[model samples]
Target: MKHRWLLWFCLLLPWTAMASTVQATLDRNDVHLGETVTLNLRISDAMTASTPDLSALDHDFEVLGTSTSSSLSVINGKQSAELIIGVALRPKHQGDLQIPSLTVGGSQTNPLTLHVEAPDTSASTHTGQDVFVEAQASADHVYLGQQILYTVRLFYAGDLDGGSLPNPDVNGAELKQLGNDINYEAVRDGHRYHVVERRYALTPHHAGSLVVPSIEFQGEMLDRGNPNDPGGFFNPGGLFGNTTPVTADSPEVKIDVQAPPASWGQTTWLPARSLTLSLQGLPGDNKLTAGQPLNLRLSVDAQGVSGDALPALSLPTIDGATVYPDQPKTSTHDDGEWLTGHSERGFAIIPQRAGTLTIPEITLTWFDVQSGQKKIASIPSHTLTVLAANGAPAPAATTSPSAVATSPAVASSAATPAIAQVAPAASSPTPWRWIALGSIALWLLSTAVFAWLYSKRKRAQASVTKPRIEPTDSTRTLRQAFLESARGDDRAIQGRRLLAWARAERPGLRNLGQVADALASDEQRAAIVTLQREQYAGVSAETRMDLAATFAKGFAWQQDNQAGTESPLPPLYPFKLD
Candidate 1:
């Protein structure tokens, strides 16, 4: 409590010393020819005040612009008001000049002096050191399939006023831009200044010493340092208390890119910080029933280091079962600094037959940025058990009648027959002594014959009412749809639909590969091949149509396979000829 009162008393002392005080100050003491300097005047504890006269300095300087901003701040529970006025002035010559004192509110500030020098005139210096910018590539050495990082920093210690800066250009490598520019306080070589840094993720096409050439940019420099204060070593030169402009060339960096190892045993080299290959719902012990479909899912993340690196993902060989390869979806992002970031890919796999199954291990290779060596990582192999298809058990053998008669309990039961039961005569014929048995047999045979005859007649009558349709019609209809889709709207979509129709119309084709090949013409096949390439190609309607058509044909073929038989004959109806 005593300290607060003491601070308040000290602050009140300033107001008492100078009533209704006004002060004027300049951000810079010097201005260059064609360059502007700012002069600021602040007024507090007063209202409706006029700005101080700058006409005295106007003779040697031109007023370019002026602005005013007011603010209120509370410190230590006391409110203070501040009104700031700024003037941008351009000097008339490259020589020492004085800015006269000006009054605001009631008090005035002392005069300030600044020195400006002539601009550098060398053409090479102007182009190389003065205005041009270039981005330098780092990590020149890298392994094949490995990633290197290249950072482009804009350096300007000289006159950069009125010039423009563009995003640094990087060519000759796969580049992924690191998020926003980094801004922080940095002291380089004992000189404290605000440094801006930007980075990119780069994957070398093939390992060799790769050059990421420089990028050029131009920007104007504002004289932000204290012009009159010579407190710092890198401050205004001592001779005349004058400040000079600084310009820098874009630093070009060379990286030693290492090549991937020649021997990656049964493993695709995936070098990344973190990677995961999990088959969702995979039997915990990789067990499966015969004819059950298997789904394998793979995910990879490598955000820690620079690389387009990823671990290989694959299905282990399951005995007697067909394995279908899954297409992968991949994506990447930069995690900022020393880390190239990561990407992920997913796949789906189905099992055909049952038995013991083994999924192969997936491997990825990359150059370790920290260790400066190439490394390979992998997703481990998996084993699965598939049970047999048929669920029936074998039957057991029966015991003979003779064996039963030899048993003591059976003989005793037979000898001690029931008192009410009558004994059969020795000469009696077998119990088929009734006429009803023959009559019933004859009746059953006659009924079966009549039913068969009636069924034949019914089928013949039905044939008269309905006619079989030619399978060619369905095939032709699908072909036409495919053709129309090719020329009409959503060609790719329509094409795929048509292919499905064809597959349904004809079941003779076994797999997707056969169906796609059989349904697609040579031109359509080429278009389909190109479509995969164009899936990630730059967006365009024409390209989209082409891709759609390509996929449509393949999928359509699959649909057609489900329709029924491969035979071109008309479908048979349960009816007789008219």
Candidate 2:
């Protein structure tokens, strides 16, 4: 009998040693109420008959997902296996939450403690309910034609299957969504919830008490109880359970819309939080030649207004130049808080004659909503020196005859003719022949001198004009670098080299967009657009352009037609608001 018992003990020793051990651990011990915590249950040295029972966690945490992984390894000639079950759990409420012990493969895992903090009060607005919504406006009072930012947030705890949140309606105003709906998590009243945030820009056209209607959200909330419903123990309906129809509504907002102030008088009513006027494409040296187009960009950037609300921006009539305006561009963007509007208009200023070209100071008057005062944004007056068409100095109004006579070369040439005439007359006996010879010599000398002066002036003009047609060494080097970089896949280097080459032509060209606009060839413009899209928008490989091939012939610049007469329009308003 003792021998038989020893034999049984020897067989059971291996089984006892191989018994599974379960350990529970959390990836994070502290988290926000709406944030998820990872719970890992590690079972070593055993295989489980079924998944772990996690029904106890239903009270304090919601199971988002679960994953299982198994691995076997050998160390020191001993083989072992481990099974890790990961659970993503979001705390249902704030405070200290306990992860109850779970039974896995007939073994129990240790419990864990997690602390969940509440959500930010400024961003969260919730009641103790399953789903709710709230609305807020940027301001309660605003000027007519000014933009008012409206935000709507929907908070829910269950799975949202489908939903529709309609835009709010306002009397005598325009309301439109600024951007796509934003999905995030937040906690209110200790309960964690999923949040959908939406923004809108509301502009009141007529000044009066405006009432923005409440926005309502209707959706189907899926009841996914116990994501790992083992054997249908927690969810009798199987993997997918019934969905409950839910609805939430935001509160109506009231805004006091005031008209333009009495003091504003007779001018375009421009209401904004802030406004700025900028001018681009001006030469760094403020020097240009007649017949050369000075590309100019006049832009207006305003906060708390739409681009449509702003007046058209135009270049004033320059004294010695003609303005040819391009199609105006206006756009509005939202930065999650304020509605910013930008209006830009490009103009080609061609100097009609060589003189000092003065671009009058431009000013825009706007109502400052923040300060409750009037403000002015202006581009200061600009003075540019204009040269002749061939980059030569402008001719003087009047040339003094005495000045030319006193010239050293002219005086020396005249003296030589006189000396030769006197010498021939004094040496020769035939007075008429000597006189005729001397006259011919004097005439020939005078013609040669005049020809030399003319040629010298022409050479100077040719030198000044040669640079416009001939590329400098630096320009050629940059072009070669750009082409080489374009052949490779390094987009950043290609962009740098391309910009450098383009700047050699148009110094004011800042970005690829401007480069595209400056190009005249359709193919070159298309190539630039494609390159820009590839760099910024992550376009597909098929859309990639062969930059070296497309631009092999070189860039074709846009032609600016010179106007026959100066514009008759008045100068831009230079009103200053103190």
RMSD of each: 28.8, 29.1
Clashes of 2: 0
In order of listing, the candidates' clash counts read 64, 0
lDDT of 2 by residue, 304-362 (tens): 88887779998777886889999999998876557888999999999987767899999
Scored by TM-score, the top model is: 2
Model 1: lowest-lDDT 10 consecutive positions: 418-427
Report lDDT (CA) for all predictions.
0.56, 0.82
Clashes of 1: 64
